[model samples]
Target: MKTVISLLFIFMVIVGCNSTKNVVTTDTVSKISDTVKIANEELEYEVIIIDPGFSSWIAGRALPRGYYSEAYLENKNQFYVAEWNNRVAQPMQYDSNLYLFRIDYDLTIRYGYEVNYLIYNYFIYFQNRYNQRLGGFVPKQ
Candidate 1:
């Protein structure tokens, strides 16, 4: 009877320990994933901002600024031309804003570092990969 009681006590302690470890492990994983997501998002935002085509037009021109406070979808194309209307200039000139635009957006990655690589690399990889797998920029036919 004494041996039986001791064995059951040991088993109960082991079971409790396992449950605690699992809970801690799950929390840690959730935290890491959240961090990676934030980092990836920031990387995307940087790519969109530094892009020469859009950066040029964004500067010196009085226009409505798009959402710059957060990560936005990046256009896969390295070079892009978007239509912009400037009525202030005599006989409004329609200019193109260059940068790949994103049609869909994910709000998860607002800040942090991703496991794959530096956040910026994600943007660079995206641009390079898209260009490699698909055809490059060309004016509409």
Candidate 2:
């Protein structure tokens, strides 16, 4: 219950191969404070999502809670995490910025409904926003 989840999301603006500068636009700045924390005390797991616009996006675009079963979310999350980790490993092939960190999601762990829901939606948001596909089916709300 006391476990602290700390995840950093550094979104860089890639102008060109030569540019190393990180740009923070007005939209980015506004969304900077939009962080969503999902924690299950009984399960002792926590997920913190600091991606810009995710808070608002989830509120407006994501499907309502319980729309999909926890099992479904877990199944989708397992597949998405696998693909995400694969991309993170092969940075040369995938955009390193998009796949910066490898997600540590264990299938054996029962992360409950809220944890799975947030993680699943974040994956959908990520895929849609970045134009990346983690699975065969198109990422949807």
Candidate 3:
């Protein structure tokens, strides 16, 4: 009788833990879809969050130049600005997002450095990834 009672208690605890996970998952989805607050209240900026499932192909071509926000690299909402003539455009990512664009250019260089860097890096990353899918070999020319 004691063994059966112990099993029942363990099952109940497991079920309770599962239910809490479900609730938190639902809440996160709702917040991502509904929350528009910027990650930093001190920084006055606009946020354009893209859901992770969407196609980010065109968005990759539209990265801004300059130094990017550290928060963005750590899965937070961030918009970065460079003080003109920076070497490469910095890009950041959020876990639930497909692509986010911060498109304000108040710079001196006519050439878009940051945007170019982002496109190049992304291409290289994907190219490397697909190359591995093809059994990691240089095609015999």
Candidate 4:
């Protein structure tokens, strides 16, 4: 059986800005459908991330692939996933649109490098794009 983990981000333009000051203009948003699929056939696991500017952000703003080890990425992903799930559980406290679904990340299973890399960068893109922090460390390119 295939364990497909889909983390869907509902895209919406926020008119007003708050403390974060990460203003997303119309030009900044990608016109094309930015759908990224991270799959490991051996593990029978797949992760689909659907967000507007994620493809462009990953190509231009994300750090190089070799910059961080798989272990590091996995660790960061664990923390990010935890915070993401927390927000998903509380719709009233957090934005229901943004935190629509909880990410199913199993720490025991080794999802390989590609899966971890994309997941980690997606978290970074998510935090910077949405002006929300999931972990203690600052989200950087």
- Per residue, candidate 4 scores C-alpha lDDT tens digits across 1-141 of 111122344422112222232221222122346776654433445566777678888899989889999889989888888898899899999877678776777766666676678778878887877788876977577
lDDT of each: 0.23, 0.64, 0.24, 0.66
lDDT of 2 by residue, 1-141 (tens): 111122244221112123222331121112236676554443444456777678889889999999999779988988888888898899899877667776767565555676677778888888787677887886466
Q: Model 3 compared with the native: what TM-score?
A: 0.19
Question: Whose TM-score is greatest here?
Answer: 4
Q: Where does candidate 2 have its weakest 10-residue lDDT segment?
A: 11-20
Clashes per candidate, residues 3 or more apart or on different chains: 7, 0, 2, 0
Tell me the tens digit of each residue's lDDT in model 1 across 74-122: 2321121111112112232311121223312222322222221222233
Output the TM-score of candidate 1.
0.18
| Error of model 2, residue 122, in angstroms | 0.5
- Clash count, predicted structure 3: 2
lDDT of 2 at 32: 35
**Residue 116 lDDT, candidate 3, scale 0-100:** 30
Model 3 lDDT per residue over 29-118, tens place: 112331211221122222222322112432443234344443232121111222111212333322111112223432221212322333
**Model 2 global lDDT (CA atoms, 0 to 1):** 0.64
Question: In candidate 1, how many Å is residue 28 off?
Answer: 26
